[model samples]
Target: MNRIEKKLQSLQEKKEKAFITYITAGLPDMDHCAKLIRAQEEAGLDILELGIPFSDPAADGPVIQDASYRSILKGTNLRKCFELVDGVRKDGCELPIVFMMYYNTVLHYGLEAFAEKCAKVGVDGLIIPDLPLEEQQPLKDALAKQNATILIQLVAPVSGKRIPEILKDAKGFVYCVSSMGVTGQGASFHKEVISYLKSVKEQAQIPVMMGFGIRTAADVAPMKDIIDGAIVGSHFINLMEENQYDLDVAKAYIQTFKTELK
Candidate 1:
């Protein structure tokens, strides 16, 4: 099994909720990004979603947009992101790394070549927001050759008829968007969103993870029973922006989520 599926199996067997932390690779700098990742692993993160900064991140909100811009200014690209993962591996960090990127970058890098590099560098999985299910087959095939999982997103309020099709195409764990809009942390988690997550969980055979608008521990606590994992991005980027590469503070902030997990 790929790292994602293995991690999910491990978590399920232990009856634990997974804490997935998201950080924009090369935000302040690649060096600092590496440090933050190490810190996250130390902070007990189950999975790390390393955001590959892009110029137009349609799925991201202002917080992640600013982070992407900052990372690009620091010369972060797909290759550098891989190097960051390599750095982590060299340091003996075993926490699964998932590359969260855009479709344009993958196309620019040449899909096959990119997948090859990811496999070579020991990447566990990928999260491409813009790549639809229909277009994922080729990429999935390439990654499968190296045993890498292609994580698919399942949007909220999707039609009941579409759930089966979406779950059929999903791998690793299904990412359920808690909100209908762009990614950002909100004050409250919608009841309807929770219901939708439950429905998706019911239909999906694989583990289901909730992302989008998950900022604080309270936002994650309620969903722990129903979802396998919680992914926090915008909020963590906001922490990085506020702290300016202080990994200790970032790690301490991430520790709050650990408290919420059952």
Candidate 2:
């Protein structure tokens, strides 16, 4: 098993769900991004969904869109992201990092090139939000050859009857979106939604971690036993944005956020 598989296995043994955090690479700069990546593991981040900014991110909401813009302004690119991952690994952090990006970035970077670099740079998983399953076979085959980076897919309720087929080949935990809309903090966790998620978890062979629109600790309460974990992006990015001038504050907030998982 790769780092992520080992992590989920370990979490299952401890009866604890994974606490995944998302941050856009080079939000302020790669150096700052690197520091936060290291700090996240220290603050109990089980998985890191590191974003690679694209010129246009259709699935991203205003917060992440602004974050991508900031990262791009600071010169973030796929190459820089790989370099940052290399540095993070060298810094002795093995925090099951996954790249959450759009398919346009992959196409521009070349699918095989991206896969090869992910294997070399120690990325445990790759999530291309815009890549359709019908178009994923070639990319999936390429990643399979790379042998390290797992292709993580995002699923919403609208995926409908094909959920099982979509997850059959998933290696790492599947990312289940919390709502139908784009990433944000206003998503509801009502009983009906919780029931739907529990049903999805029942069908998934791999751990199902929900993301997008999931905002706070209270939001995690209802997902117990049903989801293996919760994935937070826009909420996380917003926290960092609020603390941008002082990373120390941002880092402390991350530690506090981890406490909410229980």
Give the top-scoring candidate (lDDT): 2
Stretches of model 1 off by over 4 angstroms after superposition? 187-191
lDDT of 2 by residue, 1-262 (tens): 8999999999989888888888999977888789888877876788999998988888888999999998898878888999999999988999999998888788878878888999998999988888888899988888889889898877887776888888878778988887776788566643366766876788888899988787776677767668888888888788787777356765666666667676
Error of 1 at 231 (Å): 1.0
How much is 75 displaced in model 1, in angstroms? 1.4
Relative to the true structure, candidate 1 reaches a TM of 0.94
Residue 260, candidate 2: Cα error in Å is 2.9
lDDT of each: 0.81, 0.83
**Cα lDDT of model 1 by residue, 61-135, tens digit:** 888888889889988888888888988888998888898889899889987898888877778888888887678
Span of 10 residues, lowest total lDDT, candidate 1: 151-160
